[model samples]
Target: MPETTIKGPVLVTGGTGFLGSHMVDALLEQGVAVRCLVRKTSNLRWLPEDKIELAYGEITDRASLDRAMVGIKSVVHSAAITMTEDHDEYYRVNETGTKDLVKAAMNHAPDLDRFLLVSSLTAAGPTSRDYARTEEDREEPTSLYGKSKLAGERALQKINPPFDWTIVRPGAIYGPRDPALMKLYGMVEKGSVVRVRGPSQLVSLIHVSDLVEGLIEALTNPIAVGKLYHQAHPEPITWDDVADYCAEALGKRTTKISVPRTLLPAVAKGAGLWASINRRQNPLAKDRLDDLLQ
Candidate 1:
């Protein structure tokens, strides 16, 4: 598709989310017309209703997706179930929902310029000792969430839709409104930092701002079509580094506490049990713990 044909509003899924909200703000800053596919029950505090259009819908509903795609020239698929108590919910929402969204685009958005899938580093799983993963990596998703995300990617690949498409796997994202890192900050403020007992675990991380910029580039840059890219900070860091930064930022002294890896399974199991009993998502559920350990 020609760049000129991509002039219509860009449709963003998950626009109400942490990362997606930043994506919408960035696109608005660039003077791009933006349309958000949001659930009627979604919180619209992050979205400026006067600036962008809202198409009330859920990703799993094909009819809603079709309605959202009307006059849409591009799509940024950022909506997904990241943390849920139900295992099958991951497959239903992340994998099957993604397939439904893609099919909607194929059926409705005839002039679609780009379809960008926002995935996670978990989709590629862990890398070998001292080695970083590349685009050619053999994905070995350790958790159901990771597996579901990989299945979503396959939805695009196996279907091979007519429209140009790109996939971007972003590393752990941290920025304002991110609750994931708030635990670390809280721990640091309490004069303690926690880590698992093991060899130094290296992980990729990117600020939400940088990740959003990369996603926008991948969606707009012609070279990104039919390509997969890993978006993360160039340097890898350990949990200690993150804690140290948090301590420094807070101007506080902190002590490091390392829990034995042997205790992880018990902790995860307990968390899972509690979640099941309460019918609520647990922060340290087994599957999420597996992803965290990696």
Candidate 2:
């Protein structure tokens, strides 16, 4: 993090995602050349084509990853999916995908030194309202996605490839061009706010810039190697706090509604059933909803 501790030509797996695009820009700003791995049909509007090299690959496909691994010295794996009703899909992408990527790195990119895995705070599960979660905490993930991410971390640790690997767990990353925050702000614009009630009274949030800085630290800091770090703002912000802030900023009174916690599991199940009957993606899987409640 201290003025170019990491070298150039880094490969980012999820270049098209909101956070991934911010990372690409941050790396490029430091004069580190970046290569983005994305599918053929991926939208390139977030970043310009001239600033980065493109490697067409999917994490589920080993051969494609192998092709992308060539000549890449450091890897910042940011590719992941957050939406879907199926646990199998989450396992396949978040868990198995990480395994395949690490395997490919071991087999193909022998020269690769710094491997950074971008995980989530959900992997650590919920903490008491007054406590801050730490890396030493045992992983009791609330959602299937969290479980898969924790599994990925375990896989990387077990593999223990001949390289300096670091795992980073970020919390509630929000910033420009983020759709979820946009929706929240839009709700604020309309003088309405909604959030799920949870067991924990506090929430952790880190802006995209701060999250990207932590990621760069993971890449450059020698102490970060072989360690797991939780990268989140120290301050705690709750759902009500977010709503109140938006309302105060916009000079409008806000109507805040907290959904009843008891209905979440049933709603999730009903949504799953509806999705199956309609052959569509479920908005919230039961496991995910349960995680939210926690």
Candidate 3:
């Protein structure tokens, strides 16, 4: 790790989230003081309150963000709503919230050394070309979530600021404590046969630990400033391999049943309906199924 003068305290917007918490841990390991901006209702169970400064705020509230950005030299903007009560809420939180943060950061911390945006690979859209997508590829987001995230990336680029900005687009991030991968883990643990849709689909992924290192590298590296980088493990694994690995990790047999592409839409619709009736969010929403099928 490159050493630097303690310019000012770093602020992480979603410091309590899985990725955000891991980033915070990495920053603390580097002996950097962190100030976390979290909403009043957001869960803070993963964070150590005594060791870091806590700023009570929400991304949707500009005034709250303005207050949080004070004395902060750098920011890791990660407070995005993945699943929401309403579909349009994704745009409100992901796109508009990002613009608000960029404006606030420029206003309060114009001399900020680094502004790292934790964006998803989904922003680059679907790829059936059997290759890992790079930063040079054109963004053709297929879903509302992807479009919103891509919009946020565009918003950040359009910002007129003097600070160094880097966008880290991470592929499907998975590791211990990842709620997004919990459903797959549960299925593997229950000895349930996993169904692979588009078994030949090649997708890139990165362990959360490796992703943290990439984020830290982008913080001060001049090559990363004003550039978008795709962060993933060197190997791109097939969907079937992902299932097999998860099963092997859980000490279970991977009896993979391949689901036909034609039947996926119906299955996803049924899953969505079941989740709606049960008042629970389904990870296998239509867009997610589409992503898998692609």
Candidate 4:
């Protein structure tokens, strides 16, 4: 396929974040001008300060979104709250914020080529290796995060913008700059790995690099417009498989300790309570636990 010509700079929301930062790097390597939409307080450690233009703003703020959309050819919307104690925050940022962004683009970026949404597999709900999911399947999100993302997808469809729009739903993503997966690797490095006893849990994951390439294609490819795509490895891997890989990579002999499934809710609840009290995210929140066990 011939390369799609992008005229103006591509505007990326959440460019300072893990996935977004990787996207920025890829775009820069392709010699496309990049602009990042970021909050005033967002950390710039991951972003290439000297390379990309920074557009200061929050996605929820219409005015800021408008300012960011000016003269931009395409948008990569990767800004959404992944973990928060408040359930409303998911809708506020993911659903409503997305709606606001598309509205801004429609009003401001008359020449916009495309708007690409970085969504999650959770939005499509649970699936097994036996029954893989397809875009044709009904989205039955199991968590608030998933529901919000699905809602975000709907928001784009509802607006029916003249410009192209695509949604890429990636499964459990793990790579550099992902602190959550790092914790598991850390545990494995310590010579002990924890697992939930019962049925083997399966997950589809794609490396950040591969996912980024798909995202860029979804953004630039005219055929992908108005379509939703699932991006992940073809085969699913179990949590045990992941732990074993981590152990082997670190050259460490690790012990696998299984925890009772029945006790997880309590532990998750405690973690949620503790995180809530301390104004932090609960990595093992009940909603996330539901996703794991589902």
The parts of candidate 1 lying over 4 Å away from their true place are: 1-6, 273-279
- Measured by TM-score, the strongest candidate is 4
lDDT (Cα, tens digit) per residue for candidate 4, span 170-248: 9988899988788988898789988899877998889998999898778677788789999999888888898888888
Q: Write the per-residue lDDT of candidate 3 for residues 116-164, one digit (tens) a residue.
A: 8998888898656556667898888877778888989998988846888
Q: What lDDT does each candidate get?
A: 0.88, 0.84, 0.81, 0.88
| TM-score of every candidate relative to the true structure | 0.93, 0.91, 0.90, 0.96
Model 4 vs. true fold: TM: 0.96
Q: Can you tell me which runs of candidate 2 are displaced by over 4 Å?
A: 1-3, 196-201, 265-282
lDDT of 2 by residue, 145-208 (tens): 8888898888899899898899999988888988777877899999878667554356788899
Model 1 lDDT at residue 248:
92
Sorted on TM-score, highest at the top, how do the candidates line up?
Answer: 4, 1, 2, 3
- In candidate 3, stretches whose alpha carbon ends up further than 4 angstroms from where it belongs are 1-6, 196-198, 258-263, 277-279
How high is the lDDT of residue 280 in model 3?
Answer: 81
Query: In model 4, which runs have C-alpha deviations exceeding 4 angstroms?
Result: none
Q: What is the C-alpha RMSD of each candidate to the true structure, in Å?
A: 2.2, 2.4, 2.3, 1.4
> Which prediction has more favorable TM-score, 3 or 4?
4
